[model samples]
Target: MAQLGNIENLIAARELLTSSLEKSKHLASAIDKTGRKLEEINQRLPSLEAAIKTLASKCSLSEIGRHIDPTVGPAAAVLNVFDAVHMLEESLSADPCSNLFRYLSIVKQLEEALKFLTDNCGLVIRWLEDAVRFLEGNAVVDDDRYLLNLNKCLRILEELRVTEEHSLLSGGCLCAAYGKLESEFRRILMENSFPLPMASSSVSVGEQACIASLPFPVPVIQKLQAIIEKLTTSNRLEKCISMYVEVRSLNARATLQALDLDYREISLSEFDSVQSVEGYIDQWCKHLEFAVKHVFELEYKLCENVFEKVGSDVWMGCFAKVTVQSGLHDFIKFGNTITKGKKDAIKLLKLLDIFAALNKLRLDFNRLFGGKACVEIQTRTRDLIKKVVNGASEIFWELSVQVELQRQSAPPSDGSVPRLLSFVTDYCNLLLHDNYRPILAQVLEIHRSWDHAKFEEELLSHEVHDIIKAIELNLETWAKTYEDTTLSYLFLMNNHWYLYKNLKGTKLGDLMGDSWLQGHEQYMEYYATLYLRESWGKLPAMLSEEGLILFPGGRAIDHDLVKKRLEVFMDAFDGMYKKQCSWAVSDKSLRGKACQLVVQIIVPAYQKFLQTYMPWVQQEASPSRNTKYSAERLKNMVCSLFQPKLGMYGSNTCTNMMGNINNAAINQLSSTPAAA
Candidate 1:
């Protein structure tokens, strides 16, 4: 069975081998056929590739159709040249060394195509006409769509730049496109409602707010700038600047007119003159600031960034000069308004506003000119700013002097004092409390030379010093004019004391030197002495020999004459007390001392007279009974002179009266020897 199986296996193997050989033969035939076919394909590959490249160069009429206008019937064929050229570019990218000839061939073909289109094809002209019409249509639209056409036109110009025949054509188109762009921009400017919507966060009001809102929208300006940036020539810049100038001039005129009209509405008589002037000045300053800042930040910013960037020197120069001149003109006009009045005091306050504006202008000028291309213009404007500041300072000095002259009119009395003080107080507070340090310093120089090294010891404000001096002088002179010596002294003492106390109370007190206090003290002593002499000096005359006999006489002492003298002394005492009591002496210590002095002089003399004549007074009961001023009555009356409310008193009057009798006698006799 194994042998039989081996024989069968050998037979099967033989059959399998026979089948494998047949299959191998068939596979060899198939391989041979495939190898022959591949060899044939390899043989034709170069020609096939060249034919495919040629077909690729001419295959897409669709793409060509997209680029060329349908109106250009035959010139549409010229679009095929671009395809050929594109194919050559691809070949060149793949292998420049191998495809140099091909590239040259396609370039020659492109030239031939262009020449044919230019010479024989009306379709090329039709295509250009259609493109121009499309550009015109887009330009006419009041929107951003024109930018697309503008970009397309620029591309066309770039594409035609290499071709001499078409280069002039592009130039014409550029001219037309630029004209269209200018006309569109002009239209946009003319039709645009300038003064864009106010920001929701803005706090501006009245015409200022309106003016602030009047600037063109930022996006609009950016768009216009973008369009202008495309233009490269100086002549184009001139045209653009001309349009810009017209628009800016119109806005400026409107702004100025509006400002003037609003200013006219400010009625100086409607409010406190000083306050009103200040308000008007502040408002004017605000407007000026707005105008100046806008000119630099907005208008000039637009010119520099948008127009001047692409502008000619002529246009930029003219624009800058006009802008600066316009600002100066406005400033001059505003300054004229403030200076129109003869009252230089009012003008001084107004100059504060003007100076502030000038300072702001200086800062703004630096900011604006810092980035400027022109240094000469910057330096010139800087000098102009300095001139303005110096002019303003000069005006301020002149006006300050004039104001001082006006203020120095008549010396301030009680009626006129408030006005003077009000001015002084305001100016002083402004100089000290407010941050007007430089102005204060200048004012000090104008008014008086103060030692800055002695700032702490110096008077706080020179203006205040002047006012105080004036008031003090006037008060002293007025006091001197009083005919009554007592009243004059009393007035002087009261006013001077009040002034001294007030000086000590105020901020200005620290500035008053020790010399001032010392001098004031001497004045106080002098006035006190004068008052004592005027009031107390008369008391001794009333208590003369006719009034009271200090020594006793024999039998008849002229008791009726003595009684009449006593009556006269009583009458004098009552009148003097009434007059003096009504008068005011503000210093408490001074008043008390004055009272004591009067008492020392009069009381002791009366006490001595009464004591020397007490026995005589006891004997002469008829004379004493009829007398209104007895020894006790006179003592009570003398005490009441010091205490006006204290009427008649009893035994204590005599005791108290004689209590200080020795000291009073010595003082009275020593002080007033004439009376003794």
Candidate 2:
């Protein structure tokens, strides 16, 4: 019975053990099923999160658009949304999932805001257009509101592009939006007109000055600049700056054309205006260059494109226009300025002013472009020189005519010949070689061996050649004016001698040169010879063979006939003395020489007449004698014939002739029958 009860206990313990084992297997299978379901639930979690992210993106986008108050102004609504998106972007950034959705929401709402700006806020552009239309019609209108809205729209668009890369919807490029804003901005600028800057200021300083009416007048330029700033901030500078540069360049060109630079009217007063035409052009250039450089400074990559498109054209075309127009009137005025107060209002012709102007122009152009620009105007330079010369020539012709008239109205002794010649030579000296010293030195060095042809060949210019010819012609005309050959010769001799002596080391000497000096010396000699023949040649004719007294009755003298012949000769001497004493011989040496020549001819013949008749002189000792002029008395009278101004040289010739006469008288007495 105990064994059977223990077996039952064992069987019950076995059954309990088997039941525990089966329950354990069931619990293991249930744990396996739960693990499978948990794995499946874990696999579905990412999809749920993705769905939540998509929903959050839509909701965030809805919130952003709702917060944008359309009732408030469009610019204000866009500003509110832009501000909200920025805060959301910062707060949600730690969770990439939320951040991604936040960024998408920002782009979507910003796009719609930009669309509002494009469609509804286009009233800003319309206002700009109206302002431009008013300006185009020659009436200025305020555009401050338009510009402000434009700036706001551009600001929002730029902020949107700056958000995360995936924020923008499909086909939404910030650059494309930039392109639209830039186009409208440029259109307004193109249509509007602004006055040239009228203040006296430098380029850098002027750029800081506000146009009292329009501080940022050219929104086209300003908008383009804003776009460049946006692109450059986003590191997309090179991709879009070139297009902006090209558009800005085209606008600048159009503005230049509208200014009518080519048809600009310049006058003397305009040239002399306080704000010169050049100043106006300078202001224009500064405005254009500032626009170009401002854009370039926003992105350094734009420098080359800016210069190629607009900078070079501004320098060579628009800048060149200012130079050409200003130079035209200014050059003529420059020529006129120097020539004032001159003889006939034309005597002083100098190219120095023109040369100085040209130099200034070159330096100004170099400075304008910082020595990087090149322009050619050689033909214009030549034309300027030609105009000066031609204008001067007209004045010269008038002066020459005046000189001729003055000379014709006066005698050779009036000094007009010398004065006019001096003026002409001095003028040529200053004009031809640019200085008078070289001409002065060259002329003073002239000598007998100087060659005329060689000297003329070395002369400065054709104008100089013509001037010298005129001088020679005047000299010839003045010399030939005197009726008496002796007086004519005297006139030429005095003038030529004076010129030759006084012109040395002077401007006239240089102009006349060595050959002229040598020729003058020859002229002096020729005239002196002619004077000798004229004054003295007639004295010998009075003592010709026909004039001789022949006493057929050797012992008796024909007292009346001999006395009459002596009186005839004395009367001729008196007449000759009276005439020559008044005639001028300025040089002391020349006066003495002339007196000696006259005495040599007259005294010898007179002595011969006295000697031939003196044999009968002592025979007829009447108180009123036929030969009344004793040798000593004749000598004394002849010495008194020359004017006191002739000095010792004029007296000595007569004194020596007296000695000859006394010796001849003594010899005649010795040969006579009375002395033997």
Candidate 3:
């Protein structure tokens, strides 16, 4: 009996191996066949160029502009476009990653060129027909050459449509390809939608701005960009609606899972099944990945389509649209959420997927980690993951055994994600503050990889340094003066806002730090400290008043120099976007109100507040600078000034999303870095 059992087990193992291998082989074969078919299709596409040349040669050459050669100039442009469309089709037929995101950038240019030609194709052909009829009658010599070029264009159009039909059908498959693939798939889709990343990049920033030198008029670029803005707004609205639906669905599912409906105590059967909870995890992973694929795919397509319609001019267009009171409002909303719990979301998603994979593996095999086939892999994977997650119960579960005193009356925070988010946001706003204009310039220089040393030499002046000093001083005062327990939140908000405002105006790759927007979320929990529970004052008066803001306890800050520097800096920033970037601002047709909000608000309210109020508070120390005192304190200032507290709070109040991000990030840096 023992011998028979051993033999049976060996046979079962062999059968499993054989089945896995066969499936792999079948997939491999299918992939290869698809690749060959795609290659065959691509080989047949460029033949249209030959047809274009054939037809063009049949017509007499133009005396004006050269005759259309299917492969060069506009004809070449047409030929290249058709050729590209064909190749993109072939590539998608094989795999989305075959050429990666390469063809995406060209797709927009091709579409626009094709549409213009397609619309005029019949007209060009009709004109040629008329010219040919005149030739039979030996008519006017004036229009012959013009007719010849139009005839060649019509031929190029005829050849283009054949490929166009093939491309549209082939490109549709890319939706599925992208929905399934990872790695550059979304970016590729965006490239297809908007091909402006290239042209806009050519516009050198600072004094030598190439954007001003475009052969196309500035208004043309602006107009093109506006159309794209509408496209993007529509796309974003649709995506937001879709995302809300997904979030709502996910929330509903979670509610169902947490029903515990017999609410008295937990049921043993339902609880017992959770001992092997990986099964539920695995199920969620499958569904969630599917959902992400769809969501990301949709977002990519939406953005891409917008870009294509707008060209490189989209950012300029975005600059205009993003400034409307409503646009700025929505941006702030997203900025707030991103600063809240992006990290926690990323962590939980990965954890869920891994646990799900582990569960599915265990069910498939009686013992995965302990077995000869899986032992080494499972052990290695577990150790690596354990190190990364570091005490998983703290991250994943609240009910697990713990020594630390958990908050007493608060409902399990998993359910109070918003409040928990508040804690996280609060800490950030109190910690991370940024120097916007300087940071923006530095990041942009980094992005352009221009003469960094020279750029800094030219960009940073004594005035800029003074502005930095003044901003830093007041910012430090804000960080130091407040006795509020939730002071850290103020830091987080400013930092997030400053980063977005400054950097968003510049191109990517200009900043020294990673664009946290790319992959790893800025961890909200890092900012999550129990604020109200801890009775810490916002900033010590010692640090706020006497302590130099710049090198607070570290170096000397010339208080006089700081004031003048800041004034010059603020004036420069005021003009930077004055005539260059605004459109909606009835004030100036410059650009970027995002940066304006931070600079204008931060400079006056916070930067100059200490400059103004601190002197009034300390009557003996009052001397003269250009700074004016607006009351000894800001206590009744809001009431004295514009609108009194309209919200529930008698003092100024924020409606969560109505709060700030730039201040939050600034708070993060100030509280921690100097403390070190």
TM-score between candidate 2 and the true structure? 0.35
Model 3 spans > 4 angstroms off: 1-77, 93-130, 136-156, 159-244, 261-676
Badly placed stretches (over 4 Å) of model 2 are 1-348, 351-386, 389-418, 431-466, 502-516, 536-676
Flag the better candidate by TM-score, 1 or 2.
Answer: 1
Candidate 2 pairs with clashing backbones: none
Mark the 10 consecutive residues where model 2 has the least summed lDDT: 667-676
In model 1, pairs of residues that clash are: 195-213, 195-214
Model 1: CA > 4 A from native: 1-179, 190-193, 196-219, 229-234, 252-279, 294-296, 311-328, 336-349, 369-434, 440-491, 494-498, 505-507, 514-676
Across 570-602, the per-residue lDDT of candidate 2 in tens digits comes to: 777777766665566545565566666666777
Superposed Cα deviation of residue 135, candidate 1 (Å): 45
Question: Listing every candidate in turn, what is its Cα RMSD in Å to the true structure after a full C-alpha superposition?
Answer: 24.3, 27.7, 36.2
Give lDDT tens digits, candidate 3, residues 282-311: 333343232223322233233233344545
The models' CA-based lDDT, in order, is 0.47, 0.43, 0.32
Best TM-score among the predictions, by candidate number = 1
Q: What is the TM-score of each candidate against the true structure?
A: 0.44, 0.35, 0.20
Q: Rank the candidates by lDDT, best first.
A: 1, 2, 3
